[model samples]
Target: MDELLDRTAEAAPQDLTDGAELRGSSFDFLTGPGIDLAAKAQAFHAWAQTRVAHGVFPYAKRLGGRPGATAELTLLDGRCHAGLNFSSQEYLSLARHPKVCAAAQAAMERYGVHSAGSTALAGNVEEATALEAELGELLRMPEVLLFPTGWAAGFGAIKGLVRETDHVVIDQLAHNCLHEGARASTPNIHLHRHLDADHVERLLKRVRQRDPHNGILVVTEGCFSMDADSPDLKRLQALAREHGALLMVDVAHDLGCLGPGGGGQLELQRMLGQVDLVMGSFSKTFASNGGFVASHDRAIKEYLRFYAAPNTFSNALSPVQVAIVRACLAIVRSSEGGERRERLMRAIQALRGALTEQGLTVLGHPSPIVPVMLGPDALARVASREMAQAGLLANLVEYPAVSLNSARLRMQVMADHTPALAQTAAHIVADALQRARALAGATH
Candidate 1:
């Protein structure tokens, strides 16, 4: 069965071109009949090698400097391309902010590089402690706990609070770390339809009828990373409360990037101090690498600090990282933050309008992420290569990252992106897609 599927997965040998790859999804090599894990990796690696040779493999391209409207990208072959970059997730364009950089330098001088030890031991710096307090204040859920990375925070929040017997009712399109944490900790995970609060309520009701006593964590996100859509948080929270469940919203992609105060979806939905649990990563808009969980109960914060493996076993965030976020938080809460948010929305609208003008389908709301649908895996791959050649950088997300054959270019918008830049990016995207469609059609 696997062999039969493989035959139709990639582009036919006769259809090969110099800059075009053998089209296939990550799902193709994800599973196989093998006891050794290396066997599966080998199969995937063999396939990926073909993509690299054709210069169409989109992942893991190194950035020469901080990501901005115009940035440099280094491919695996050591070839460098500088162009209008819509790849990196620097929403507020704060990664290289003068103040952010200054804070990092000062912290480095005082504490040196690396946290040196796990927080469970001796790595809790005063900055991290202070940052926790600041985040707590912003969220209005005065109890907070921190983790080294955003992934760690999401995973830890789940692994720490919920027991194996507890139920995890999550959105089907929630982030991978959230899903993985749920799978690792519990067997009774119920995935509701994407962004459907009604579906979640149905699952919650069903779970309560069967296991009313066990804890239920209704997991979701603020601004889903791929689709850029948001759940009705107010409704979801109310439903969770009615059914005796706790709602945990991962705001990794939204916090520090949305709202007038940069409080993200929680603030937009007027849920700042109301939700049961709010967790988010600073990497997206806060210009650093850290994440935190904000809750109303101080006891939950302390409980997670000791119980969460990602928190207890892993090292705390470095002083430099802590300082960067502190500075960014200040910027995110100021009038300047509001101005940047306005500018960001303008860029998003401009890009969306331009893409739409070119007959492309732009998904979701006017968020930092702009997902332009391309439809087929082959077209997406070919278009990605064409975009690179044309000096435009945007991510082509196909199966495994998205649904099968529902490929799209997930462009990350920056606050500093000008209207001119957006228009130029749209033209490049349209031209590339048109060429890809023409080429693919010819091959068929």
Candidate 2:
């Protein structure tokens, strides 16, 4: 609709080569030495506006209605089609559950659509209070704090609790919110190789050696979204204890989808109570848009409530969101939750096996998230486009999201997706990969 294929200018002669040809108009904006911020953004927008015609960018097709394992999607050319979806994070498929929907509708009738103000002022409804208590009980923590969004929770946790004198050590593959929070928390930041607890201990040791009394915080995810792998929480917790550093785990991807009672990866490893802090999102598993930070220490919880920017400034979760999350949480704690998780795992394994049987290199261990290693930016984009055209919708991750040469299709399997559906999607992806390889000049 907004000039999808119009390039801002003609390509330079030298820019018509291999890697150079793939460089969009942002090359000058990103790499040029003396360009002003405004000019760079304008140039990038001009380039991005034309990418729809190139069959890349604006990755997700517009959904005409409710999204599920299979849904109707509208392409850029206004062609509507039904597609098997592997791009959603609704692992339990609770978003569309009748009970959850009913709870939300009832809450909307009682409390309206908006929270009205920040929790610090007038936004702390009865539903919010009840949800917080439930989460606290679930985590076996003394205190729990909520935020409007998971991103805000992570950002606020580090910024609110860690001082300028603190040293932060985070997993290299931690989510962007954690990275941003660490950057804002302190200048003394260290990164450890993903899932490498030894590296984390070494960083912690180095920090302790340098600043004997400075507080140290270690952050990692329970399940990484891109790789679909989880660290050994027991080992990480031991490292933190030996180094006298606090460990914080973000269980956004694993909680409510793994372990007994859906306690998350940490609970599966028997390190739930040992970790100093736990934060997670309700959006992924609980089918609601909110986040919580829980800890055994009441002081930290109070401090966050008083100082966290989100708690202090952002509006709290609406009653409807809280109600749906509460309903989903109940389901996650029920026997049906286990059955759904089993289905989710079966779907993941089925798809993984299918992709591998097709001679595609699938990355990571058995998890709801699966990534097919496509390699190179161009190949990944082409494969994604072809796959979309073939009626399978998956997410393509390239440079910036991942390494330049490690571009991939990040596929997520939901409980509602049948094994047959997964296998069919895999076939489509395999066919798309072949086309993409031939297009990118790869043979075999």
Candidate 3:
């Protein structure tokens, strides 16, 4: 491995020459005299083309027209279709809710749309400040800092917290954002087996034995997005405390639907107070576009507010989004809100039970996110396409995103979906799987 790394490093500069022809070919098309912007553009285009050729190109198309499933999503050849939307992170289906929409409209009327500049450069909108304070109070944290996106939150937090000598311990199946953030910020990062508290403990012991002075940060997801499985947060938190390590929980998937008041897996396990840092995305449950990091320590929040690139460089959350999120939080905390939670849970249970009864290997517990383990990438893709044809939009997970051999159909159950709808979708998936298996056998 050392020799390979050395050789790769040696060849890094020379690798750029392989695309020299493509780079030079585009230079004449540019009218700019300075800045060598044409070279950068050519390199970017070359990389994009390579990704497309590899069948890994993402978001190459746009969704046009409406707000719901009938919207002309880019992948469906721009046709307006009403398939069940399983790919969206809008967990609560609050995006089109009348109350949420009305709140956003009201905010627009009162404060206009955009914040006009970065939050630090100009005083952030009052609505944004209120939302942050509300979130901090709801989460039982001292303070909270918001970012433009979840990626920014992850990146900025890791960059702000860790130093060169510090080490980060993360789950092997952690999100790309966390992995990238840790990699860019710290040199010593150890990825432990997914959801294995024992493995994390052992790694921490080894790191401490090697360098007792090394600052350690353990990272894991509250609920994994792909498998929909939650970690043993109580055990992990205990282990982190025992080892004098800080624990950071990424509650992106679980925050809206999991805990007593929708606080998340950590809160469900009574470990929220023990957790050192909690990060989440508002785009999912809040049905808004932004992310936040909460901590009991005010100093950490202040440090990230000033030092984190996401907080300083990016534009603050729109006033309209902030207002909508505040309204959503109010609804989520209301006494009547339990009905929506219960309804969604029942829908998830019905769908999961139906899929399991059909003899499909459903991953995780009966959570809102249900994944049917369809082996091989080709079969998963075929199943997804077939389900779309059958009036359901299930996502096909494959290489790089998940284990190459463990492709599956990732389906999310919404509160609006009735028991009948969930069962119908499950049957469609089962039928598609059987047909796919038969076709493969015949071809073989």
Candidate 4:
């Protein structure tokens, strides 16, 4: 225990006060000085290596095979642990579907895996074109443009359409990509409180008073990944319309995983085809690494094809990737998709209930994510190590990823997660927390 807690020999006394404390290890990478980039990483690496030795680092554990309710995780020491997996973000469990795999194989046979060029020139394939049409139909939008990844889609959607003169009114808790895209394009960015439509309204009104003629793009997410909550999109869209602003919703986490026919928040809110722009990723509920943006105007599609650097410069989604997503979409729209959503909801409820029964404070509303809040950051690190050792694998989100002293476990569920697994996992988590709190309490 002494060896596990000792600082590295070269660590300065200041380091002992900083990263030697458990709370500082997670922030070095986030708040570390960028002037000497390698120095920042070196400091973080020193602190993180100690966490690894203590088996509490809990990042970048390689997977052994296909992901599901349970998976084989290979730790840093080359030891494999098979545990109840709650780390994967796949809500639909479609990654290993037989039809999806078969579609990939067929597309590989036809297109030889790669798309061969960027979509702006020669990489556009028939499968992707058909996918765009299908997504347009599913989203109930007039046009769709595909991107290489979900991140690219979010970034490009804002970067492509909004000019430097345009103002962006975004949620405070919006995804990093959206913030980065807005930062890259313009300096006129206003952030409102998270999920506060009234704040959005005030910001919209403020921006209009200052620059009535300039375009204002209102950005938000359909589902916040960390907290498992959603916003009132209907009121937000109306606010944007009243203020003469464009509303764009990023459905990366919820699309194809929520709402009727897997149409996501817009559909459930009865605002499908009503928002000015919609963007989503296939990696969440669908079975591929791709994304798309939908709009009610054809000009947006044509404009993005040429203007969006990701679409014009980057290689389009491979034929196999497109085919895999196409197959997943077919299932997402069918009666089987409805059944899977029901199963997913049940699994979500079961896991949340199990956690609550264990006396853990579960955050936000019920969704695939059940955030079990563990405070003080230090306790979360200890609890993470205990959970890993106890053969229960889940993500340990601490400072920077969340906030200081608000660390929590973001347990993601799949459609196929069984009730028995949920109950057992909850027990393991509870036991881990008990033991961790005792050990951390004794350390003082």
Candidate 5:
């Protein structure tokens, strides 16, 4: 039976071409029996090289400066153009702020750029301590533990705290790092539908019925970046409390972009201190590299600080990054931050409205991310290519990132995007969608 299954699984080789890849590659490197991994990689490289020469594959274009709302992008054909950047996560536009730059320079001068060792061994610098303390205060948490990067934070928090005997129930659409953390921590993992409280409750009840004594962690995001929607925090909290489980929320996308005072989804939902744990990234809104896990439970904080691999093995965030984050946090808590938040919201609303008016399907509720759902992979690829040709930079979400049939053009809005730019972006995107539709139909 095993041999029969193996024999049946083999796929006949077919001619691979650019058109096939743009429509979605049929290659399955994982399921291929005794597959030549190196050869497959070479094949993919050839395909990518072909696409890059044509200016349709826009993975990473060489950037001249800080990747802001308007910056220079070097295309695949080696031609540089000033493009309207809708791919940046600088919601508050603090990346180029004078104060942020000044703080970084001062820190670089004082600390000389490197931390030299992890915080555990060398002790944290003054800026690191200040940043952690400020984050605790802003998030209204008793303690906060910082990681070198947001990816490390998500992966470390779960792996450090959750034991092998523990159970973790996560949203199906949670970030990839969170999924990694959950899987690495324990084998007893359950997935709940995105934002489906009922599904979570059912899973929780089932787990409780089987292992009432084991610790259960419920994981979710404050604002799902891909979908640009938030869960009902109040309901989720209540459910977790009723089930004797702890809830962890990642506010990486919304922490410094949404809510009053940029307090994030917890603040917007009025559940700041009610949730068990809150984690986020400073890179998005604070314009720095690092992430933190804030919680009232001091034991969990200490455990993560000591056991988390990133914290234990990885070097601490540089003094410059720490300083920049400290300065950005101060601005985010000020009146200027409030004004910037309002401006960001205006851009989001205007762009979403325009896309909808153009008869395009816009996904999610009100947020800085405006994703125009374009269904087919080929269609999304064509639209993105057309948009770039028109000097607009947007992100393409396709297979593995999202469902194959749910490909989208993800546009990120910044607070400093002018009204004229926004209007022009809308028209360009509308035209691109129209052209992509025709091209896709013709190909079919």
Candidate 6:
């Protein structure tokens, strides 16, 4: 494993140099006397320029310039096309709902655009408190806390909950946020094979053998955003209980999509009450920008509220966003919301079936997110381009998001999509797949 990783790392620089040339530029004035900061800045800028020149730039070219790509987006050529937006995390199409938008607009009128301060500061504590309480109830947790974003939520929870002496076992395919957070928070971290509970048990036993006094935390995601699959939560909960470890599940992708009542995969598995901690993003299903950690224990919630840097330092969620989320929550909790969720599931199934009939390989279970496996990076990029041309907006996910040679198209189905629209999207994606296959065949 180490040798393979080393080889990949060694090849990264070589790959960067294939299509671009790097030129050395001098900055004598910036490095001259009485310019300490300037020298450092110049050095960093030089490194950055070299990276970009060597084809290591990470930013995707934004061809479609639009607020939301449900119908059309203006591409890099400044032309409009019928766009299928598979990249958005808004799984339920609640972002553009009239109720959500109206609430946001009303909140803007009531409290301006920004939160203006952190939650610990003079920001709207009332809204924060209310949101935490509402989230707690929705997630079946005793208490809840919010962070500025999902990245911060993961980082804060792992760091705040575990000590250096604690053993953190994570899924191999867990989101980078979880792995990175655990790595930053504790030195004793082990990664197990994806969704393999037996591997987790083996690692837990090894950790216990090495350090019997150390605490253990097992981490996994409810629905993997990239692959759209879920871990066996019931078995995971039982394993955590047997090992005296706490289990943390990130439900960013499944929070408003899965379960019997839209609570998530844990809920669907009837293990919601078994998991120790649950974290999810409000951005996707709730159609709001923020992240949260929900727990049955009050102490844990209080600890994170004070210890989490993002919660204490970052500005509170904007009042408008809070209002929007509040509205979304109301809608999701009602019977009408159940109907919407059902519609979403049906749409997902329909699209998946159509894609399968068209002979395209789709990953994961029959979830709202249907990932079309395109294999190579070049093929994935070409398929994405073709789909865009055909009036479907799909995301071309490549390396770093998934393993090398596992590039795919991540298609997210929304509740608002009609049957015709969903079928049309599948056909467009199928055509795109054919084109990509043809191009690859010719090249080979």
Q: Which candidate is the best by lDDT?
A: 1
**How many residue pairs clash (N, CA or C atoms closer than 3 angstroms) in each of the candidate models, in the order given?**
0, 0, 0, 0, 0, 6
- lDDT agreement with native, every candidate: 0.87, 0.81, 0.73, 0.84, 0.82, 0.74
Give the alpha carbon lDDT tens digit for every residue of 91-113 in model 6: 66777778888988987887888
lDDT of candidate 2 over 1-444, digit per residue (tens): 113112111321111122432454233557544547587677666555455545555354677556688765665544444578787788899988999999999999998898768887887888888888888877778688888889999999999988999999999889998999999989988989989988887898889998888798899999998888899888888888888888899999998888767888877888766789999998788888999999998888878987999878888888899999999988988899989988988998899999999998998887778999988876676677677767777888877778667888999889998999889988999999888777667421
- Please report, as a residue range, the 10-residue window in candidate 4 with the lowest summed lDDT: 7-16
> What lDDT tens digits, residue by residue, belong to model 1 across residues 1-444?
122222221322224463336466678887899589789898888778778776667788888777888777766655566688899899999988899899999999999997857777888999888999998888998999889898999999999988999999999999998999899899999999999888998999999999978999999999999999999999999999999999999998888778989889999999999899999998889888888988999899988988989999999999999999999999988998899999998999999999999999999988999999988887888888778767788888988889988899999999999988899999999999999888777766
Candidate 2 stretches with Cα past 4 Å from truth are: 1-21, 24-36, 58-61, 75-81, 442-444
- TM, every model: 0.95, 0.91, 0.85, 0.93, 0.93, 0.84
In model 2, how large is the Cα lDDT of residue 205?
A: 83
lDDT per residue (tens digit) for residues 1-444 in model 3: 122112111111111122321122222343544687776667657754543332222224454542342223444123222455555655666778889889999999998866746766784888888888888776788688888888889888988888889999999999888998899888899999989999999999999899888788899998888898988988888888888889888988877666668776866788766778999888777878889999998899888988888778888888888888888787777654566667778878888989999999999876668888988755564455445545565667766578776888888766677777778778889988887566445544
TM-score of 1: 0.95
Judging by TM-score, tell me the better candidate of 3 and 4. Answer: 4
**Which 10 residues in a row give candidate 6 its minimum summed lDDT?**
3-12
Considering every candidate listed, which one attains the maximal TM-score?
A: 1
Residue pairs in clash, model 2: none
lDDT of 5 by residue, 1-444 (tens): 122122221222222233744644424332434557577667666776665654456676777788787876665556554568888888899999999999999998998977657866884887888888898888899789889999999999999888999999999999998999999999999999999999999999999999989999999999898999999989988898889999999999888778887888889999877888998888788898999999998898888888998887899888899899999898989998899999898888888877777888889988878888978776677777777766677888877788767888888889988666777788888898888777667765
| Best first by TM-score, ranked | 1, 4, 5, 2, 3, 6
Over 296-401, each residue of candidate 4 has an lDDT whose tens digit, in order, gives 9999998999998888899999989999999999999899899999999888888889999999999988777788999988888888777766677799998787
- List where candidate 5 sits over 4 angstroms from the true fold: 1-18, 35-37
Q: Lowest-lDDT window of 10 residues in candidate 3?
A: 7-16
Which model is ahead, 2 or 3, in terms of TM-score? 2
